[model samples]
Target: MLRAAAATHLRRHIITQRRRIATPESIRAVAVDPSGSLTPRAVDLATLRKTTGAPLRDLLNLDIGERTRRQRRACVLPRDKAVLLQLGGLTAVINADEALFFDNGGEERPRAALRRIGASVEFAFQHYKAPAFELAVLEAVLAEVSSSFQRRRDLYEPVVQKQLREASCEFDGFGVDGLHRLSAFDGALMSFEAETRQALQVLDELLASDEDMLGLLLSERRAGTSVDPERHGVVELLLEAYHRRLSAVAGDVAELRGKVQAATELGRVTIDLNRNNIIKFNLYLSMSAVGLAATTSIAGIFGMNLVSGIEEAPLAFGAVTAGSGLVGAAVVAGFHAAMRSQKSIEQRARHAADDREALTSLLANMATVENVFDDACRDLTRPAIAARLEAATGKKPSEREVEILFDIFDASHNDKISLREARSALHRGDAHPLIT
Candidate 1:
């Protein structure tokens, strides 16, 4: 009887345990702020533990603002003899005027920017195989970007242009109803924004997949890398694609900067032209004064008491007056020419100086472009750069130089530097040719 009773008790205990859900041994939580205003007062962990009943877990530094990102980790503790880890951005407080809310860990992290531009990467990769391939990989990449932009233009151009043209010339925004109707941009811009997001997602996927293959590609970056050279030439193609893409984007950015500088140059040129016009007006005014004085001389002679029959013969009087006016005009013009000879040369010198200054500014911009080009090359074609340097400089570089060059190639330019540009830059800097 005792043995049967003990067996029943054990069974009952098992049943009770099975029916109750065991609470986790430790519970942890973290907070994220999208408001940017929630700068928490500095908390002394020890004091907090003493003042409040809450246990001290860990401290995290975070930045939260409009388009800002913050990451936090919860306390690590054993739960039911097992580790329990929770990773996400669920605890966040967002506020108005912020463009985005990044909590809940849904948004991609910082290192994934490359993923945002995948179409460009694929377009750049066509150069992995034979050099004799019909299409220039660079051109192919540019065409793709152009196609994408053109597609966007087709969708939004008409609407934007129309709105810009038809918008009430009244630029006021204080009115209640009219303010609401104010133009931020063409309504099509919003539509494009949505499409851009979808395109970005697609690009992100492509880049993500490319990154998965990075380890393999990196290892193959050694001499004569080939993955089925007869077929895909996977790594080579991918590298070329990236090169083209970076170059194209960089070129666009460069072109925009160039245009801005050009506009500034134009403004300066206009000022100079206005100055020249002023000088020309001054000469015209001086000539006009001489003609007036000459006419007055004829009038003075005609008014003399011994005028005789000059006034009676109108035709002779007119001829003599005209001849005097012509001679006076010639004298004025000669004086003007002499004055111009003295000062115009000086004006030319000043204009030349201005031109020199403008040229210097252009050189500075070009230098910046050179740096951008070097960076792109390092990122897209490090091996090619390294090989080129080795052939030219005879003085073998240490691993550091090679590393530095590769870094320079990537960090210098934001896009691809053309072979001509790269070579010229080297020559300008007193560096040897890559091949020579």
Candidate 2:
């Protein structure tokens, strides 16, 4: 009696364990026929999981199923005969011909998904709305991604053009909105690239894997049937075509990236030019203030408590006033001459036919005015200026030669450089041969 009770208790415990079910989430399982007929039926999550052998956790947590969760465009699980595809704003799942379309409480189906994969297949028995072939499901995913990107590219290109057009207009330049738009577009492209790469990777794996062959042979073995080479060839051909299509799309993405980079470069140059003009205006204002300050200092000195004998003379007041006026005028004239000379040098350098000469002239002005060359002379590690010099001359310039060039560049004016003076300076300093 004791043995009988123990056996019965163990059997009851086993029965309870077997009856335990996973969490209940309602789902629709649509059975697809090669005859192009779809029969959708509602099923519980547990039943669906059992039927497809897909993990319940993976289905619930979409990220768990992703090979590249953060950046994956598509994922294929050929072992389970399943695929997860993100197309536009929709995510679709395919288990061979049967699919579980996640509705997210929406009324309308993903038109992009349905249009590509849901073609009519007429079998000997009947006509059904289903994927014509197993590979057609993957093709739909690719089509949706390509179409979405094309639409985005079309919308984005015009915006970029507008930004480029308005680049000349200071107030209307691609200031904030342009940057935001570009960032958004770039992000979209990056996502597209990642998805395309993932898709290609999956296809390549599929082509290399013996898993499909094993599955086919195993199923046939169970049924006591033979393998069909023609059916297998069709799958291989479709896979190759898909790979080629992805390769072409990748090329398009690369071209788009290039155009965006060019547009960004132009925008940056415009901003830099605007900044330089502002700097020029500020320098002019500072020079004016300095001249006025000089005049004020002279007047202040004359107004001191100590009276001179010249104050008693009739013409003393006028002479002192005239002397102060002349002093201020001289200071202003000197500043104006210096600025004018600098401007002339810059204009000449910009218009120079020889790039080397132009670069030298530019460096000269920057050396004297901005003291860039002084710092560079002290520190040989200034690679930016070094690079500029090398590009112009096709040779790495020595520190001493760079210093000599700075002095000669400063002296250049109106596209004319005193080559004799430069050569003499080079001889005295570095003994480097002048380019002239």
Instruction: Compare the candidates by TM-score and give the number of the best one.
Output: 2
lDDT of 2 by residue, 1-436 (tens): 9999999999985564344334354554444444445566555656656755667544544432222213324545543535544444345555554555554322223332343344522331243343234444455545545544443344334434454454335335535224333444455555555655666776777667655633322233334555565555655675677678676766666676666566666666766777888999999999999999999999898778667576789998899899999999999999999999999977765543343343333332221212222123222233555564554334575554454344334244432223333333223232322111
For model 2 the local lDDT of residue 228 reads 65
RMSD of 1: 27.4
Q: After superposition, how far is residue 65 of candidate 2 from its true place, in Å?
A: 13
Tens digits of per-residue lDDT, candidate 1, 76-96, equal 111111111111222221111
TM-score of each: 0.23, 0.51
Model 2: weakest 10-residue lDDT segment is 366-375
Off by over 4 Å in 1: 1-233, 248-250, 253-287, 303-436
- In terms of lDDT, the best-performing candidate is 2
Clash counts for the predictions, in order: 17, 6
Q: Report the CA-based lDDT of candidate 1 relative to the real structure.
A: 0.35
CA error at residue 97 for candidate 2, angstroms: 5.5
Q: Which residue pairs in candidate 2 collide?
A: 35-121, 36-121, 36-128, 36-129, 37-128, 37-129
